[model samples]
Target: MKSNLVHKVVGSQYPLWRTVLLIIVLILGLGQTYVSTHFYLLYNKANSQHHDVHHEYYISVTKPINTVASMSNPNANGFTNAEIKNIQNQDFVDRVGAFNPTLFRIVIEPPKGMGHQDFRTLLFLESLPNAFLDVDTTNFKWKEGDKYVPAIIPRSYLDLYNFGFAQSQGMPQVTEGMIKLFVFNLEVKGPKGSHKLQGKVVGFSDRINTLLTPESFVNWGNETLGSVSKSELPEQLLLKLKNPLSSDIGSFFEENQYEISKSDGAKAALTNLINYSSFYVWLNGIIVCALSIIILLLVVYLSIASSKTEIMQLFFLGYGVGKIALPFQKIAAIKLLMAAFISLPIGAVVAGMIVKNSAQLVPFNSAGFQLQLLLVFGALVLLICALVVLLIKVRIKRLSV
Candidate 1:
């Protein structure tokens, strides 16, 4: 058959070394492309899901405090309705919640026999919506008739007591479980009347600073026990952001003379560090793939140049340029297909290894690994094969002429 004669001619023209070199470069380019794409998707998913974490995208905003000036009018440090509206309209903000502080006075009396028999101090409680809280809120709700109140205190409070107070006073350090077991009496005093309620610590938070109770509790306390008018505005605001790295955050806060805590700033800095590192990894993989592509093209050119004389003879014998180029085109297509197929298992194994090793430091989800890898690399191999086939046809046509 005509095909058999063409194959014999083409097979003799390509040397063993050149064929081997071509296969190696194709594998190199395709494998690099697959691996890089896999990690890019992995980190991109991580970036999108990070907002769900408490300390990453949510930050508390407050005006700068002037203690002497705030004594007469505490509302001076609070945000006006206009200011709140402006922040809500900004492109970076997703949602905003205010910290509603209790308007009444409260004194906490610890359970007896805990070695602090005479410890009683005025305590302040603030409430935010349950959606903003990081802890489980099933047990955090309160009704008007409930005798017991559940509270969430800051983790830093316990750390300060254990590391600083306990160590300094030579007292025993208490754990979270122990704190939750201790019941206290909350003596709420106001112009209306004085009421005693039982309270207990239910959870701890690292994001919010003050002691927190259910929003329902705070509203009920302000209505029943608080002496102050209900017109008091909130002094602090919590903002959920769409993108924490947006320039609008710093500019808007600076222009309004608002301040964010040190912990929020640290979280933003850490996020920036991670984003930059991922970008560099993706760039390096791109460079390697590009270099491999160039090497593969060089081998193709050399193979055609060596067979130029035979191609011219075949053209003079009435064979078409298309027929003469078919064998070389088939070689490129088969090798590219081989590379694409082989890289799948290899890439999955490498990605699995990476996810396993970094599980503790970073959570990497490899959920759609095979499907995405297949679609991305399938298109890449097809594009490269079409390019290589076109290159062979053009070079052979020129040689035959």
Candidate 2:
């Protein structure tokens, strides 16, 4: 019976409590890393394409302007230099461009074949850089001898004429291409003097409103006819956001009481989702790590207690604590190292399977370089195993032989 008991005690594996806790810790470690990594990759992939994460919208400050004359520097628009700089510095904005106001007044004579009587309209013109213009500018070029000033009008004007003016006046609705062929005379007046120039519509824009001309044409027209600008700054600014759903962009506008032209109201929600998921993943890791440490301590204590008889016998036989403790230390180190080694490949395979399946659902170009993911997981495993082995060594030394 004594010999049987000795064999039974020596052959015993980890107790049920230790085994269950070890499994839980192992699962948590693998799961936390894999889940966090998947979300991280998804977030990066979403941000990388950036074809159109959000819809196109316009932003401007909202100050009181009761009347045309009540506006603060209406001729210069409401945007100040400091305000422009503040907007441009925002991380969400991809680019910002301001409208260049025509220093001249324009008198429009009715189209040649449109009406029988004398009809005229007074208007102003604004222009932006060619890159911002959506129209084909091949024929929009200019020379001193050119008769017609090529103009790219807004699509809103077409909608108005189609649904409002033409319907009310019993006139035929016109198409964009047809309108481009219709020529009208512009009596452009500036501080220098007035000149009559023929102008024609070349194309229409979906975003920009008001009459738009070439930047070169506007500069030449302003220099030749219009008086020098009273204010150097532009009257209207065009802000292009890099990410439409950015919370920073929305918050800034709200805090400043700025007006937005259009908002999809989706950016803030998406960003919040990413942030919340990240926060939860971190919280889970922290909790699991704490629990793992506690379980490790308990396991160490229970293991030492189980072998107390043999350990004490060794001490009484002229053997040192170091000699008896060495086996337990080696066991602890080997178990942890093996777990780390096994878990690394398992975690990697799980991550790969998830990414591959996700690609099938919504295809994306796989990353050619994933050294960051490998390095991060490898370093974490190395660090955790190293710390656990060191702790095991210390615990073994403290065991009373």
Candidate 3:
């Protein structure tokens, strides 16, 4: 008697109105997820494009020419630690590091026969922390009697030397590759003593316009041959900004009376703007997801309740709550799977269209979306299915006896 009633009750459920309503709700929920994900993905793609083109570039901080120091310190020409601390707290600034300037004079002894008479040149050697270096410092080992000082020079400095200095002196213009090809020797004479050092042009900086040495080598060299005339404060600083193009950033520097020079022209600023805008799309997507989940809960409840008589009959016939909930769980799972499958391609197509329209502005591959998005979509589908199944089980347990 109970088995026939259970089958009849289960088979009799034809809640056409509830089905129609839930189908509409599912479409809206899926649409929300797609819109949110697509917007954020566009921003990600744009930012990636900027990085690929300007990977070797950065912006620099400078003091106004002929501007006297606000405070009376020897390193007044550059920013002080207090000012730097404030700058680091800003959202527009991405990275910040400094160069340690030598307090005393440096006289270099170039290799014999290769150098023409510029040995007494007062050279300035600055040290930046190892973290900021982009090149491989694996061979930058400095030891007693074997001082092989790996060096990084500004590309502009090399260009000036090759074009202006070499032209005036009637020397051949040397390419960047050629400088790294040769091993060179140098002698540095300080107030304490003179030491022989090997110099190799390992890399170039597009951001900082200074001769850079590893921080380890600088700490050791300063202790050994440094003069007592100067302190440890840096004269110039290099800034890595997150959004150099922001109006607030530009205004902040101008108000502080600081100078800004960018190696990547105006590209960094534009990329930051796109990031900010895309973030809003992500937030809207979140709102849509919240609404969709609510709708899903209501839809699951109605579907299960419509078949309540059959479910209760099964329970009285010694059916487990899990078994009674299984059919409703299956329905919810199927709907969720359908929603995800339909939403993902639609989102991808929309994103591709946008990318296509913006091809001139932000160049991307012809393939529209990233594989990571597909993984995230799969996770979303599973999560929704699991939640709906749990919802059905809970309702089944509550309704029994």
Q: Over the stretch 259-340, how does candidate 2's per-residue lDDT look in tens digits?
A: 6654323443454455566557656754665566556656755776777776566556665555555555555555555555
* lDDT for model 1: 0.79
How close is every model to the real structure, measured as TM-score?
0.74, 0.52, 0.61
Q: Best to worst by TM-score, what's the order?
A: 1, 3, 2
User: Candidate 2 — which residues are off by over 4 angstroms?
Assistant: 1-13, 45-77, 81-221, 225-257, 261-283, 286-290, 305-363, 368-375, 399-401
TM-score of 3: 0.61
**Which of 2 and 3 is the better model by lDDT?**
3
Instruction: Give the TM-score comparing model 1 with the true structure, all chains together.
Output: 0.74
Q: List the residue pairs that clash in candidate 1.
A: none
Best by TM-score: 1
Candidate 1 lDDT trough over 10 residues, lowest sum: 47-56
Model 3 scores a C-alpha lDDT of 0.68
Off by over 4 Å in 1: 1-8, 11-51, 54-56, 162-175, 228-231, 276-280, 305-360, 363-401
lDDT of 3 by residue, 1-401 (tens): 64454445664563678666666667667766776676676557656766644433356666675544434454556667888898888887777787777655555555566657555466767887666665566765556655467778888998998989999989888898888765566566557766767777788765556887667666666778767444456656666666556568777878988876653436566555556667877777767766776787777776568877767778788898876777667667777777767777777776677656666676665364666566665777687778778977898899985
Query: Per-residue alpha-carbon lDDT of model 1 for 37-86, expressed as tens digits?
Result: 77776777766755444235777888899877687676878889899989
Candidate 3: lDDT of 304?
A: 65
